[model samples]
Target: MTRPHGRFQQAFAKALFSSTEALDPAMRELATQPAFAVYRNTVMKACIDALEANFPAVARLVGSEWFRAAAALYVSAEAPRDGRLLHYGSGFAEFLRGFEPAAELIYLPGVARLDTLWLEAHAAQDASAADAAWVARRTPEQLAALSLRPHPAARWAWFDDQPVFSIWERNRAQGEVTDELAWQGEGALLTRPYDTVTWQGLTQASCVFLDACAGGATLQQAAERALAVDVKADLAAIFAGLLSAGAFTAPSSSPASNERTP
Candidate 1:
C-alpha cells in the first residue's frame, strides 16, 4: 500500500524541518543534503534576524544572547505560516507573553507587536497616500459607502496598562524620562508614510474605530460601530484622522476577498 515517492517526500520534508538544530545522519546522506542543510539554516536565520529587527527595542531591553536564543527556539518550534514574512511575527508577541524566560518583561509582548506593525506597514504597497482630491471626488452617499484601507503602514495596537509606544519613542530618541506617566496604560496607532514610522497615543474610542476597521468593516460602518462605545465619539474627525494618517483601502472588486484591514 506504500508508495516509494510518497515515503521519500515525507522523509525529505522531515529533513527540511530538522534544519534548525542540525542534519541528522539519515538526512545527511541524501544527495541534496548540503543544499538542504544550508537552506534550513538560512530559513532559521531569516526568522531570527526578522524577530531581532522588528523587536529591536525588545532586543535592546533583553540583550542579544537572550533574544537570539529565544527567537531561535521560537522559529524552530513554529515555522512561518505565511509566504510573506512581513507580518509573520504577529503571533510572536503572544508567544513571548507566554514564554517563561522573558516572564519579567510583562509588556514585552505589546512592544513586539508594535515592531511587527512597523515592519508590516513599511512593507505595504506604497500607493500614493490618498489625497483631499480623492475625498472631494466622492458624493455624500458614496462617502457613506466609502470604505478605506488603512495605509499599508497602519497598525492598531491595544495595551492593558502600559503606555508602550510612549516609552518606545522616548527611549528611541534617547530622551530622559522625567515623568512616571509614561507607564500608564494606552493604545497606539503606528503609521509610516515613507521612511518614517511614528507611533501616536490613542484613546479608547479611537482604538474602537481602529479595531472595527481592522475587522474589515466599511468606513461609515466602522464609525457607527465605534460610536456605539461612546455616544459623543467624533466619527468624522476620526475618519479624517485615519485618512490623514493614510489608513484605509477602497473596497476591492473581489467578492470573495474578505481580508481584514491591517
Candidate 2:
C-alpha cells in the first residue's frame, strides 16, 4: 500500500543515519556524494543538540562529551518524528534506564524524567490556577462533594529509591551540591500557573494526593488518600500549599468531565 515517494522518503530517512550501502541501487550514488554527507551530519547534530537542550540535568550529570555521545546513539535509534525539537526526547529517560553506561548512576534516569516533566509543564496548555479563596467559599459539605481537576500544566512524580528531586533541582538551578544532601526517596511537582514554569520538592504523600485528584477524586477523598500514604501528613497544610502553588483548576459542577490527567 506504500506509495513510491513514501517508500523513498522512509529509505532516505534511514540512510541519513546509516551507511550508504543501505540505500537502494537507484539512490546509492546520491548517498555517497559530499553534500549528502554534510546533510546527514547536520541532521545528526541537530538531534543530539535537541537531546542536550531537553535533558540538561542529564547533560550536567555527565560531561558534554559523554552526553553527546550517548545522545548520538539515541538519535540513531530514535529520530524525531516531527520538526518540533522541543518535544523530542520524550523517551530519553526510559532510554537512560536501560543504558549500560548509566548503570552506575541509578539516579540519572530519575533526574532525566524530572527534566522531561519540566518541558511538559512548559509546553502545556494555558489555564487559570484555582486559588485557596475558591476553596474557602465552599461549605464543608460542598467541599467534600466537589472534585478538583489538575491544571493542564501540572506534572508530578515520586521516585521511590532516589532523592531525584533534590539532585535534579540543584542541577537544574546550577547549584552546588553539599555533603549534607540526604540520600533518600523524594518527589517533585512542576506547575505553570502563569507565564513561567515553577517547581518544588514534594513528599510521597503529596504525590499520592495529586494522583488521586488527577483521577477525579474529590478534595476530601484526595486528602484521605494522602493520609493513607502517610499517617503523619498534615492535610490542612498540604491542601493549602498545593492551592497556593496553583496545582489545581477551579472547581466546577462537572469537574470530572473537564479533568485532564497529569
Please list the residue runs of candidate 1 whose C-alpha ends up more than 4 Å from where it truly belongs after superposition.
Answer: 1-25, 28-47, 80-88, 133-145, 171-176, 214-220, 250-262
- At residue 242, what lDDT does model 2 achieve? 87
Predictions in order: lDDT: 0.71, 0.88
Which stretches in model 2 have alpha-carbon errors above 4 Å? Answer: 21-23, 253-262
Q: Candidate 1 lDDT, tens digit per residue, 43-143? A: 77888887787677778778889999999878866777666666667778889999998788887887777777777777766544556556766788887
Clashes of 2: 0
- The lowest-lDDT stretch of 10 consecutive residues in candidate 2 is 253-262
